[model samples]
Target chain A: GAGVSQSPRYKVAKRGQDVALRCDPISGHVSLFWYQQALGQGPEFLTYFQNEAQLDKSGLPSDRFFAERPEGSVSTLKIQRTQQEDSAVYLCASSFRTGRDGYTFGSGTRLTVV
Target chain B: AQRVTQPEKLLSVFKGAPVELKCNYSYSGSPELFWYVQYSRQRLQLLLRHISRESIKGFTADLNKGETSFHLKKPFAQEEDSAMYYCARSAGGYNKLIFGAGTRLAVHP
Candidate 1:
């Protein structure tokens, strides 16, 4: 069985540049989540989606960050005007019904902002 | 806000010795806890969940509501057990896992 998968395993962006990361969750999963992990730190919540509906995005660090899960299966995280501080690994995970079922995570996209 | 604390950043033990990686959490309401492990050059994977109460890879963790802790323990640590371990918590339907900084355990023969 396929697990959650991410694209562009690695990316390097200059300061102020825009970048987009993609995530493909397990089939039929209703809940999808995105997290950002800085160097030597644990993953931090960024946004969440249940089906095509974005239930919460409070974890997005700034207005420059945006995420969408239009079909409830694929998700894209876009960061506009990236800063050096934004350099981190972006991880995507999915579960059956949010809190009830365990989540399966992808290898993640390591974005390095210069 | 829910938070997880891993007292040690790194732990080193002999391959045949007992291993214990501590985890503590703080949340106002009842929250589910979990232990996730990441091997070198591999993606992070779930080790165990408090609700399931099952052991994996000879490792076990018990949630102590009184102490607000869930510590991972193995009777005889194996060299394969060396990896990065993270403690996590989930509250409500958020599906947002609050994770600790993580602990790196190294087992030597």
Candidate 2:
């Protein structure tokens, strides 16, 4: 892809239903990050992957939230037993170098849990 | 804890008028500050970072350590500048960025 690509631009889930969102970062980008953005609020960090290793998951709201970047190029954000609070825009971003502000963001997956 | 603050939720300005969007932060150690913007139905993109002192699209922001402020300023505002702006901060060694609540700027022609 020319840029970061996120799947299922909009998602509708029933409460307690599991859902998976996918993100394809820019080719060869070393750093990948996931963020959650509520209405009228800025994006909040959820997890970060420096390659195939998930270095940071401290921002995950709960144990139900899980993310993985097994091969380092494509990543998945899985939410088990989805709750109403999980409704938000899940954003994916990739950067060429670590600790740098140069990042490109995807269109984001707007998840709506009913 | 590191936090970024964008006091105004919305700001309106006339074309060719000066525009300044205030940003403040609170972090224990040295922090890197950044500004991101999003236009209508578009993805968020980085505008600039404090690490680079150069201006972009006629906008420039300087990091003031003592005051813990990174205010973005432009001498002349254009209607094309209307968008939502966000302030972000990250502590050294941590690649995670904490963003502020964001401000929506409206430049009228």
**Candidate 1 lDDT score at position B35:** 94
| i-RMSD values for every candidate model | 1.2, 1.2
How would you encode candidate 1's per-residue C-alpha lDDT over A1-114 as one tens digit per residue?
389999999999999999999999989988999999998999998989999999889899999999999887899999999999999999999988875557899999999988
Taking chain B only, the TM-score of every model is 0.96, 0.95
Q: Per-residue lDDT for B1-109 in model 1, tens only?
A: 6889999999999989999999999955888899999999888889999999998999999999999999999999999999999999986566589899999999999
**Stretches of model 1 off by over 4 angstroms after superposition:** none
The DockQ scores of all candidates, in the order shown, are 0.77, 0.78
- For candidate 1 chain B, which ten residues in a row score worst on lDDT? B89-98
Question: What does the lDDT read for residue A62 in candidate 1?
Answer: 97
**Could you give candidate 2's per-residue lDDT for residues A1-114 as a string of tens digits?**
799999999999999999999999999999999999999999999999999999899999999999999999999999999999999999999988785856899999999999
Q: List the residue pairs that clash in candidate 2.
A: none
> How many clashes does the backbone of model 2 have?
0
Best by DockQ: 2
